[model samples]
Target: MKQRLDKAGVRFRPHFKTHQSWKIAEIFSQEGIRQITVSSVTMAHYFARQGWKDITIAFPLNLREMDSILMLPEDVTVGLLISDSSTASYSFPKSLLKKSVFWIELDTGHHRSGFSVADFHILTWVIDKLCSTGAHLQGFLFHDGHTYNATGIEEIREIRYNTLSRLSLLREFLSEKYPGRNFLFSGGDTPSCSQELPMEGIDEMRPGNFVFYDLQQLALGSCQPEDIALSVLCPVVASYPDQGRAVIYGGSIHLSKDKLTVGKETIYGVVCSEEKQSDMRLTFPGDLPFLTALSQEHGVIQGTAEQILNLVPGSLARVIPVHSCLVVSNMKQLVSADGTVFETLNLHSVDF
Candidate 1:
């Protein structure tokens, strides 16, 4: 992924919100990934202290964290996301403002966050406030999250093109008004970034899920099933032969409640087996089962007679998570490919 971006001359600022582990982050650091994007101030501080020189808290900036953001060491560059004019009202210390870049989050039809393109008035209002306060309005940052729902490559391409087209118009407008100032347009989402998208106007990519694709990505066609890098290791607690269901000791908490519709059925996760556990890459082989339902502590996997017979009490079953980010976020620890255990950020307890 880095090679592809480097070849295209697009800056890679991988989002760290997917895996909030410093040890996991070192893997990227070793690959020359000095800059990163995160979702929270806690994550920004955590990565900054680990010697990451550039970090962007991609989520809308929290006004309450101004003090903490100001306290960050001068050597570490921090960027903030501002999606609305309300955020522009908060005053920042001159020192902090000088060291920060504000990416105006553009709503490229995602409807989740950012100012809508049709509502250019909001963008103008926010820009005016930033300029008045001497804040650095870097450029536009976008994530076409709607692409995640796309079922085909062409649909994804259409969504990406629409987003870029809107961004190009906004970029032109910003350039015309603020002459001679370089304004960047950054865009990313696994579905759009994993595939080739129009990069004429986009200056950078900030994809986080590509680091750990999941069943959701597979279903979205963002990646092949073999590209998925993680799965849930669950213990088979009980087996009901009459019903042909194997109950596992993993559920919504372990594998998030995120569901994907495959055919007519909505599944929480795809199931693999203990025998194939050594091969972490999940293909959801035909012989494997699937998690049909999940409770807080129990996951019910249904399979054929041969498959159900294979699962026994005290045995382990591997289930590919629907969403890797939510699964990792809820967990306190993770087991690596080499069977080494490492702690993950307890995001639930984090103040931010």
Candidate 2:
């Protein structure tokens, strides 16, 4: 992934929020990935303790967490995102605000958290407050998350193009209004970055999920089936040959409940044979089972009666998650391709 980004001349500052493991981060460090992106201040501090100096808290600034945000280690250079004028004007510690770089989040048609390009009022308003408060405005950043909903490669390209076009237009406006200030335009989703979509004006690409593409990215044509890097190892506890379904010990709690529409059915994951996982090469249109349904602690695999018979109790199945990010958050540990087991700090960990 870093090779692809370097070849494309795009700066890679991957979001580490996907796999919150310093050990996993060590691999990225070995690959020379210096900049990092995370979802929260707590995560930023976690990585900071691991000696990550350049970090961006990708989520919008939380006014309530000013105490913790301000206390981030001084050795680290932090980047914060501001989604609206409210966060811009929110009471922030001037010391931290001055030291931190700020990126105004652009909506870019996602309808998620970001200032709309059509409404330059909010953009300029936030910029004005940043200027008044002496906050370093690092420029605009956006996430073309809508691309995940695209049907195919062509549709993905179209959505990404339109989103980038809006960010470029807004960039030009910012350039003209604030003549001397340089604003870096940053944006990317897994579908855009992994597909190597047109990213002419984007300064840095933060495609976290590209590290571990999942069923969703596969369906969006962002990655090949073989490119998927992680899967949940589940044990078959029950097999219903008559119904052509098998029950596994992995479910929403382990693999996440995110669903994707593949063909006519909505599924939570792709169930590949444990043998296939050992090979680490997944073929397209392969004879893998689909997870038809999921409960809190159980997953139902759909397959033919004959195929279901193969999943007798005590057997294992590898489930490729629909959303790697959410799945990783739910998991407490991971096993690398070479069979190296490492622990992960579950960002959303809770005691039952």
Candidate 3:
């Protein structure tokens, strides 16, 4: 992903919420990426303690967590996201407001958070209000999350193209109005960053899921099978060869309940053979293995009789997650192939 961004002529400040492992972060640092993005203030703390100096909390600024937000280590330059004008005017801490950089969140099409793309009133209002108070305004940042539903690579490219074009227009409008005001346009979720999308208007990208491409990214055409880097290993407790299925000790708690539908059936996760997992390759079409059912603590894998026989009694089935970010949060730590256990956030992985 860093190479993808570098090729697109933009700076890479990837979101760290997907892996959240300081040890994993060491890998990113080794690649010379000095800045990062996170989902919450607490996550900022986790990475900050690891000596990450430049961080952006990608979520909206929580007036509730203002205390903790302000207490972040002094050396770290924190960039906060704000969607409402009120967060810039009265509620924001006056002392910290002057020093902190604020990025106004604009909704490209998601409708989840951020001000509407059509409404520049809230954006200009917040910018002027913050400027009057001597606050460091960092221009516009958006999450083009709607690209998750893109039909194919072409559709994904178009969605990203249209978004960058619109954001460019807005940047010109703001530039003409403010004259001499320098604003950095930051955007792009995994879909846009991973696909062959336009980056002419994008200054930086903070894509988290690209770090560990999942089954969802595979379905979106944003990543290839080999790009996926995370999976949950489940132990099969029972198997039925005649029934062509096996029950495993992994479920929603281990792998979040997120799923994607193929044909009329739902797929909770992808089931991979031991040899396939060793090579780190996945097959998503034409009789690809998958989990058919999931409860709180049990998952049923439906496959051929041979597939079932191989999973019989105490064998391990590696299941690729539909959402790597949620799975990482659930598992909390990662065990490398060499049996190196890497801790994440505040939780330790189950030591074997």
Where in model 2 is the C-alpha error above 4 Å?
Answer: 274-286, 347-352
TM-score of each: 0.92, 0.93, 0.93
Tens digit of per-residue lDDT, candidate 1, span 305-342 = 77888788899887888899999888877788899775
Sorted on TM-score, highest at the top, how do the candidates line up? 3, 2, 1
In candidate 1, how many clashes are counted? 0
User: Per-residue error at 30 for model 3, in Å?
Assistant: 1.2
Report residue 301 deviation for candidate 3 (angstroms).
1.0
TM-score of 2: 0.93
What are the per-model C-alpha RMSD values against the true structure?
2.7, 2.8, 2.9
State residue 275's C-alpha deviation in candidate 2, in Å: 5.5
lDDT agreement with native, every candidate: 0.82, 0.82, 0.82
Per TM-score, the best of the predicted structures is: 3
Candidate 3 vs. true structure, TM-score = 0.93
User: Candidate 2 lDDT, tens digit per residue, 177-197?
Assistant: 899888887776778877767
